[model samples]
Target chain A: MSEIKKDLLYTESHEWLEQQDDGHWRVGITDHAQAQLGELVFVELPGEGDELSQGDACGVVESVKAASDIYAPVGGEVTAINSDLEDSPDLVNTDCYGDGWLFAINVSDESELDELMDADAYTEFVDE
Target chain B: MSEARKTPLYDAHLAAGGQMTEFAGWLLPTRYTELMTEHHAVRRHAGMFDVSHMCIVDITGAEAAAFLRRLLANNIDKLEAPGKALYSCMLNEQGGILDDLIVYWLEADYYRLVVNAATAAKDLHWLQQQSQHFAAGKLQISQRSELALIALQGPEAEAQLLHQLPSLGAQIKALKPFSVLRDDHYCIARTGYTGEDGFEIMLDAAAATTFWQSLLDAGVTPCGLGARDTLRLEAGMSLYGQDMDESVTPLQCGLGWTVAWEPSERAFNGRAALQKQRDDGVAEKVVGLVLDQRNVLRSGYQVFSADDELLGVLTSGTFSPTICKPIGRARVNRNIGNEVMVEIRGKKIPARVVKPVFVRRGQIMPGIET
Candidate 1:
């Protein structure tokens, strides 16, 4: 069983949303997604200032077994990407919800967050 | 889903926390711990693998040697000693590879063959059909499904084996590559696919679990199919179904050296077609590709020439743990140059073409290093 953070918002695609102090949203893959992907060998991050749709493919996470696309949970403009992942991709495996956050974004529409699942709903969604 | 067959070491793999997956109709471990950790254990220390799913067949009678000579691409006459082993490919009538196997001359009238799990039945059928054409004497084929095979591979493989079975250490240590020693209950061979010093031991199925436990207690890491694939790929060893199959010939699959054309009079199965193929020319060849970027290369990726003409496709690809880079084998046009482009996810990435051997005996081979 994987840990589901109670305060975070999640997408059906497994990305998590964290509200940062700057009013922007911090995003990363959930614990369940990283566990299923195994050891991460390479991570392709979206560029800062890039605009993304709610369901757009934002980046890629590749393991020894296969590669998976990371989809945007909400429409936003990328504010900052996790540049540390370029040198060390396994951080996504070690701390998926913390330092492994993929990219931060400035939300274009606050209503998109209301469409996301809360922790309790996400836990049930992933379990199903 | 239909129930998959379990190996004798299935319980042992479960106890070791192996992630079980379906492979060749059998449930087997893909990895016990992490892929790279298990892979490095085989390169630096020692690792054990449960390869019992491989089919073992024993051929006997006065015509055994002659029967093999007619059926296989490699000459079995090379095995002069009792326990000598030879790696050969059983080809179809059209010179396409049926399966690659190791044949051991156990005695004057008996030889043993170990083949891939998925191709065992087909290979056996081909062997039986080909044996009907032999003129020397009667041939007997026995499938030994009662035996379990395990491989202990690495630089310290001998040491670990000696530590476990000390009484047989001296004799096993003296066994050269491609040689075997059989006792009442064990058949230990000095051969492996990981390009390392190792022994592939065959024992009774009933004793497999206990033997695996003992090896585990002796500190030999338990490896799975995941690490095994990476290690063999790094060593340039070809996989049965992926690298070559019924539609692919040895000439195109980088296995031409396994073919024996000697005694020009000897007519092996598919020899005529192979001879004709040799007389004309082979169209494609398998070569190693080292990706310049950090991108992961995978099978079915298209290879292109510098000017954007399609060349061939990758047969086996992986992130090589030992080299810490992405490497793959591709069957491409014979005229392909040193540099080629591999199309991955609609992006054409440049890769360097080189010999298939990236690493051998724990040492990195030349031209593969970044």
Candidate 2:
């Protein structure tokens, strides 16, 4: 079965959000998404301070077969991007939920987080 | 568009963690592990791919040679002896490519052709229509739907093959490149899409599972189409739809050598148009491009001259596992110099233009180093 963390919030597009101690929300692709995308060769992420709208196309994840767009699940201002993935894209394959985190954002509206799926809802959604 | 077809090895693939994908109307494995693992396996050791989705065709009769001579751009007479293979482009009347295929002369009156899976139906219809001009009893065209093919490739391919079929050791060892070894069980051809020493084993579809298992038992890593594509792209082999299609001629796509112009007396399909193109000079030709950056160069990317003038469109592109760099083939202006730019996602990245061949037999070519 695909892993779905109980604490982290999920998006239908397969991105996960974890609240940082500093109130910034951390984002990364779920294990299910990484499995579907195969081993990633490259990941283009948003720069720090770039503003994004809900469901806006942000980055691209490219495997050998094809490229897929990464989306911003909720509108926010980009705080920090994962620079490690630039050199080690396969980190997403090995540890998609941990070190493979994409970017952290300072949300314009914290209410947007409630609209996202919880762990049980995302698990059911993925299973379906 | 309809329900995807499955190869005989479908269950075997699924059991091996093969990631399935729909390709050419068949649901085949794209990669069993990851693209890198399978791609490097073929470069360093032995790997096998279930290529049963490709079409296997047999042509026989008294006029088989005559029919093929007129049908293909390459001369069928060049086979010289039985079990010899010839790579030819079946061309339309306008000198456009119908499909690029490999034909093996099985005997005096029979030949075997392996064509691209995507063009199998169209090719069959064209073959059927063209064969009407030949005498009914003199030519017989049949699609060998009951056969299955597997490509065993890499440096250790022969060693692993000998481990399984030790009885045919001498025959397999003596088989030259582009030759076939035939017996009661299989038609083993020393031909492969990857630029590696390998065999394309054709056996009964019913026997596919057993053979696939035995090869696995011999330690041949089961590969999928993802590695197959990257390997062929690094080798600079032209893919049918990506590199050449019905809209392009052989001369325009680095297939001019496949067109047999010698002994000009025999007129093949698209002879007049090809000859006219040769005489009139081809405007664009396929060339190799190597990107120094880490980004991928994909198909449909625009090619530009140093001054940003549009030259042509890229046909095939990929990150080469063997060389660890981005390489691709493009149809650019014939008069182009050594330097060109490829526009990837609106950014023009400078690339070095060179000859198409990148890797062969696991050895990187002289110019492609780095």
lDDT of 1 by residue, B121-189 (tens): 788888778877765356899899999999999999999888877788788878999999988989999
Q: Write one digit per residue (lDDT tens) for candidate 1, span A1-128.
A: 89889899999989999999999999999999988878888898889999999899989998887699989888989999999998788899899999898999999999989999999999999989
lDDT of 1 at B245: 95
Local lDDT at B32 for model 1 = 88
Q: Report the lDDT tens digits of candidate 2 across residue range A1-128.
A: 67889899999999999999999999999999998888888888988999999899899887888788889988999999999998888898888888999999999988888899999999999999
User: Model 2: what TM-score?
Assistant: 0.97
Q: What is the DockQ of each candidate?
A: 0.63, 0.61
Candidate 2's residue-wise lDDT over B1-370, tens digit each? 6899999999999998898999999999989988899999999999999999999999999999999999999998899899999999999999999999999999889999999999999999999999998999999999999999999999999999899889999999999999998999899999999999999999999999999999888888999988999999888899999999999999999999999998889889899999999999999888888987666778999999989899998899887777767788999888899989999776799998978889999899988864
Q: Give me the runs in candidate 2 sitting further than 4 Å from their true place.
A: none
